[model samples]
Target: MSTNTEARLFSPTTIGAIGVVNRVAMAPLTRSRADMEGVHSELAIEYYRQRATAWLIISEATNISREGRGYAFTPGIYTDEHVASWRRITDAVHEAGGKIVCQLWHVGRMSHVSLQENGAAPVAPSAIQADEQVFLESQTVERPSMPRALETAEIQRLVEDYRNAARRAMEAGFDGVEVHAANCYLLEQFIRDSTNKRTDQYGGPVENRTRLPIEVITAVAEVWGADRVGVRLSPITRAVGDTPLDSDPEGTYFYLAGQLGKLGLAYLHCVEGQTRGDNGAGDFDFKRLHAKFGGKYIANNSYDRQMAIDAAESGHADMVAFGRPFISNPDLVARLRLDAPLAEANRDTFYGGGAGGYTDYLPLADAA
Candidate 1:
């Protein structure tokens, strides 16, 4: 394990109990390619199975409960049918000798009036409203409504939802579970301030803000074991309905990373983007945070092949996760390995669609 540049790319690494063949992971990007009920279809199975060459696959944001739904057609792990649908994909990946994990999520207040259970308003850490305009079909709509603050009891329920999702994921034959704390989801809303306006124990300072994520992580670890559970955090992505961030995000997340390290979880996944909704990587340094979270570090957002490989080689990241690139290049690993050109992603059919731009992206040969 020489700390040399070439060694970085060629190095074999272990993140907790899982062994990665190399440090390239398929980042979880929601394609909304599932059926309306959010079931994993044959299309998804084929899509993921093609990338078995990657070290691991983090499945798209999956709801653990009905109240967790935010985006339409996102998959769920809360129901029996959902588990059945997922098992097909996991089984396919396993047969191909690929490892995968289900990313457990609760979108919190990032939902619409029509997207919730019984069309109820979305829920969050507090009642603060974030009026992020989200796309639905051919229309742009403001975020559903001001979210109802969760009672202490409801918070506990959410933790249980995450735990149950972990159990179900294992039952469906997933290798592990990654708690989705990144991108201003439920956990981020709790961690960041602009959105979390509460006087309770779960709302104030950094410890309290981080409490929910820790509890959920601890709970999921109990089910899947710490070595098999991972957590993804985008310290910079203060998304649409999420929260505002720190004046010193680097120090903030560095502290948070140190805290997460104590749990002995498998890996700590992060992204290099501002939490602000500027469609830009927030302008802050990630050097300190990267050094501290020293386990398997997975970087996401706006990364291409050479840059991703550079991150891995520089020891800044253990692996690189490609979000948009993986969408159009199911054989993305092979493409990168062979230095082949990638097919451009179809923005038109990215979401709410059949296989037009979804599963129809051919490999390099077909593209030619």
Candidate 2:
């Protein structure tokens, strides 16, 4: 007989208008398996379909514009070709009976010259450069030089990028779109102090720093409707030069959360903390963040089966998102439900590779 370790995590639940078979969500993981032009690959299609057991799946970050790209070999949703390629993946997941959301992103100053067009300066709320080294391949390269502050006109254009991407994602057959306003990306850069030091209507003060995010959210909600739109936040993440650590990031997100809660969004994904590496932020107060953001909260960061179950049961998080574990365990949801041991993933084959660790991780019966 099987014990009920998955009682909370595996329980059926609903967030907004989306009905989930369970509360386990698959957080978006950047696999770097796409084509040179950031188009989705067949391998990606298989990888996502294999793990459709989750209540919802947020696809890897897809750059909303060329300048939005921060790495090599990732996918994009800004072009017709990009849309076609992702449609293949979305079609496959739908056939498997799963709901998927595309995470639209813009990297801001955390980009490299190698990833930009003619090495154009990255655009941000201010001219500040995070001045950090980003590891792409074997060697670490200096980030693309600092960017000039985006003009109000340019800021409006970036918002359109998100709007167009959301429209394309829907046309390509996705359930919804999540505006990536976290992880020190472009949106997050504006939300924090270290980066968004501007004197325009879009900068300074809590309300101004939050203007871009709310605008982006409004655009996405308009295109996908509030019911299908969600945003991710990492108030505690100290990526790049972000600062002042929101001694109460919870309060910051609380204000943002309550504002969003009124919009009737499908969900709010809390990155938990900085995810620059496998070992997430060692210092994080998830309970406090959860208290502030009262909607359907999906918590991500080094989660294991029992911890996820406990979080879901205790109401700390409505759902749990697993990243590294899902890399090798395609049947992660099934494994957790059965309390079966999982196959450890091959970190060696993580980025820039074929389908070795991408899709070769076997199911439970095969592992047995």
Pairs of residues clashing in candidate 2:
none
Quality of model 2 by C-alpha lDDT: 0.80
For each candidate, give its TM-score against the true structure.
Answer: 0.92, 0.92
The candidate 2 region of ten consecutive residues with least summed lDDT is 239-248
Error of 1 at 72 (Å): 1.0
C-alpha RMSD for every candidate: 2.9, 2.6
Query: Per-residue CA lDDT of candidate 2, range 1-368, in tens?
Result: 22385487887888766778888888888888887688877888899889887758889888998888877888899899998988988888888888889999998887776778987877878887775565454335555567778888888898899999999998889889889988888888888766778888787777787888998899999998888887898877775544335444655666777777777788888877676543343465656655555677888877777777777877878888888788888888899988889888787787778889898888888888
lDDT of 2 at 39: 85
For each candidate, what is the lDDT?
Answer: 0.79, 0.80
Off by over 4 Å in 1: 1-7, 135-142, 275-282
